[model samples]
Target: MKLLLVEDDSDYAATLSRALEAMGHDVVVARDGVAAIEFNDRDQFDAIILDRMLPQMDGTTLVERLRERGQTLPVLMLSALGQSIDKVDGLKAGADDYVVKPTSVGEIDARLHALVRARGWKGEGATTLRAGAILVNPGKHRAWYGDDALDLSNLEFKLLAELTRHAGSFVTRTMLLERVWGYDFEPATNIIEVQIRALRRKLTASGSPDPIVTKRGVGYMLEA
Candidate 1:
């Protein structure tokens, strides 16, 4: 997932950034609330990690401003103030979740997953995805084509889920690298082509017309 991390503490921010990258998340660091707002305005992010105390603007006020602007991105507020009242105040300001400072990256990752699950890709309570004859259930880690269940590996399932989510829209190779392989830096191996080849082979095993469309130099798309 792509994330925007708002932190004034450079050292702590660097450490946390490294940890999140190691967990396969791409992070953009913002040193202050103003920088955070700028980053949020410029790009897309799966979530935002905010610090309570910030230069230029406070975290609560920043969240409130984002809400006022009609941005619904999930926010996880971090603060040294671990009191129950502090948490309540953060939530009231439009933060999706609040975590105390010095929290582990594992805890943060879990919380982010929970937030994504709550704000499902399809809808508020959507659990399944469909593109043409293909059907995918990410929560169950299962997929099917017509009446036949697709036997996909872990990575293949994730790759297919992303494709099905977009359905008719083309998905770029870069997007697949970040979303499926979770790599901020590209590897030397042609992993995307290899995985797509394998997935394609399986998908067409039932003598069905290939649903994945390759645009040669552009990207891949699942036919809707």
Candidate 2:
């Protein structure tokens, strides 16, 4: 899952981001509501873990704004313990679920899964995504190009899934590093180049034209 984690506490955010990434979820941290909005606008995410009390703009207000913008993605609000709770406000404002701070990552993961299932991802988070002849089913951990089954390693499968998710759009190296590799820092190795080449090779081995496009220094785009 690609996740947007909104929190102001650096230590808590870092700790939670590590835990979530260890669970195979790609997490992007946003320190405040303003930054959260920017991240939300620039990238796609399966869900958002938001802090209720945020600087610049509060979580509830942010939820309202997001809804007003026609964004229906699941938002799980994090409320600090001992604070006055407002279940009505959050629900009315369009937050899907609420979790108290200091909750287990397992619980958060479960809630996120449940939310996705309940909403059926509003089609955007469908179980399978397709890019022209390419088909990727993350839930089943399988992919295919045309009629040929793709026997992909875990990394290749993830890379393909990311490209399929944003079909026709350039998925930058930085985005792939964060989403597909789950790395906050860029490594010295040419992991992206290697994996992309492997994917391209497999994709075209069956006599199909290469659908993945290299935009020079920009990034890669999978033809739609």
RMSD of each: 15.4, 15.1
Clashing pairs in 1: none
* Poorest lDDT segment (10 consecutive residues) of candidate 1: 120-129
- For each of the candidates, give the backbone clash count: 0, 0
- How do the residues 1-224 of candidate 2 rate in per-residue lDDT, one tens digit apiece? 89999999999999999999999999999999988877765566889998988899999999887665445678998888434457667777899998877899999999999998898785434556777767677877878776477989999999999998999899999999999988999899999999999989999998999999999889999998
Alpha-carbon TM-score of each model against the true structure: 0.55, 0.55
- How does each model score on lDDT? 0.85, 0.85
Model 1 misplaced regions, further than 4 Å: 121-224
Name the weakest run of 10 consecutive residues (lDDT summed) in model 2: 122-131
Judge candidate 2 at residue 132 and give its lDDT: 70
lDDT for 103 in candidate 1 is 90
